[model samples]
Target chain A: EAGVTQSPRYAVLQEGQAVSFWCDPISGHDTLYWYQQPRDQGPQLLVYFRDEAVIDNSQLPSDRFSAVRPKGTNSTLKIQSAKQGDTATYLCASSSDSYNNQAPLFGEGTRLSVL
Target chain B: GDSVTQTEGLVTLTEGLPVMLNCTYQTIYSNPFLFWYVQHLNESPRLLLKSFTDNKRTEHQGFHATLHKSSSSFHLQKSSAQLSDSALYYCALMRGSALGRLHFGAGTQLIVIP
Candidate 1:
């Protein structure tokens, strides 16, 4: 089975520009998550969903960040007017169920740079 | 607010020695789950172990962590270190709910020198 897959393994955009990263989770996984990992820090959950319904997005910057999992299988995380602070590796992960935080499979992640 | 802490930002140990990584957590939720994740350079973080039962040791890939609810700690430990064990380890905590989102610590970088 294929693990999570992400596009544009590397992305570089100028400040104030916009960029969107896509994620394809593992087959049959019902939970998907988007995380922002700044350098030297752990991956922080920005948003997560179960079967296309967002469970929580409080950590996401309302003004500049948005994530969607329309089909519950693939997700997109978009950054509007990207700032230097938005520069980090965006990771997408998925779990088999919604009950446990057991082990989540991750993609290679999209390394974004705002210059 | 819920949070996780890793005291050691970096640890260097000679190969064949035991490895210990300290992890502590604080959460208001009564039922909390703890986890340990390993991230290699330029790769995404992967789960190393998780805590569901109190005082129950969870082991994976030669790494183990015991969740002590009394102390609210889930520290990762390995019997012996290997060069391959060098990586960044993150401690995480989550509530068993609809959210199920994990709150992670800053992470500890382990370096096993030959």
Candidate 2:
């Protein structure tokens, strides 16, 4: 089975610029998640959706970050104004089920650098 | 609130040595699932092993870990280290009540030397 796929494997942007990351999850997966991984750190959950409805987004920066999964299969995460601190890897993951036993499959991740 | 802690930032061991990376977690729920993910350079993190049953050991790819609820720990261990075992390892927790969220620790980098 094909795994989760993400576009623009790397991105470099200046401060105050806007950038968007796209994700295409595995077929038939019902849960999709976006995570931010800073250097030398583990992935931190940013937002998640289940079948086009956002389940949790409390960790998302409301002022600048927004994510949408209109079709329940593909997702887009946007950063309105990027800062240097925003430099990190953006990972997309999907799971066949919501249960804890089903481990999520991860994408290659997009590495973003804000200058 | 759920969180995971991996005390070791870096572990260096010679090939053929036993390996152990400490992991501990805190969660309000008792039946939380613990997972170990390994990420090689330039690759996505993949599941190494996971266990939800307290005190039951789960083994995969020569690595094993047991969820000890009494101690609130799930430390990854291997009988012998291999040069190919060098990678970044992360301990994660999935709350039984939470559907799809995973709380991850700060990760541990393991280096197997010859």
What do the candidate models score in CA lDDT, each in turn?
0.88, 0.92
- A57-93 per-residue lDDT for model 2 (tens digits): 9999999999999989999999999999999999999
lDDT of 1 at A64: 91
Instruction: Give the chain B TM-score achieved by candidate 2.
Output: 0.97
Q: Score the docking of each candidate (DockQ).
A: 0.69, 0.68
Lowest lDDT sum, 10 consecutive residues, model 1 chain B, at B94-103
The complex in candidate 2 yields a DockQ of 0.68
Please give, for residues B41-78, the per-residue lDDT of candidate 2 as tens digits.
Answer: 87878989988888899999999999999999999999
- Per prediction, fnat is 0.78, 0.66
Please give the lDDT score at residue B40 for candidate 1: 90
Model 1 residue B73 lDDT score = 93
Give the Å error, residue A85, model 1. 2.3
**Total residue pair clashes for candidate 1:** 0
Deviation in angstroms for A93 in model 1?
1.4
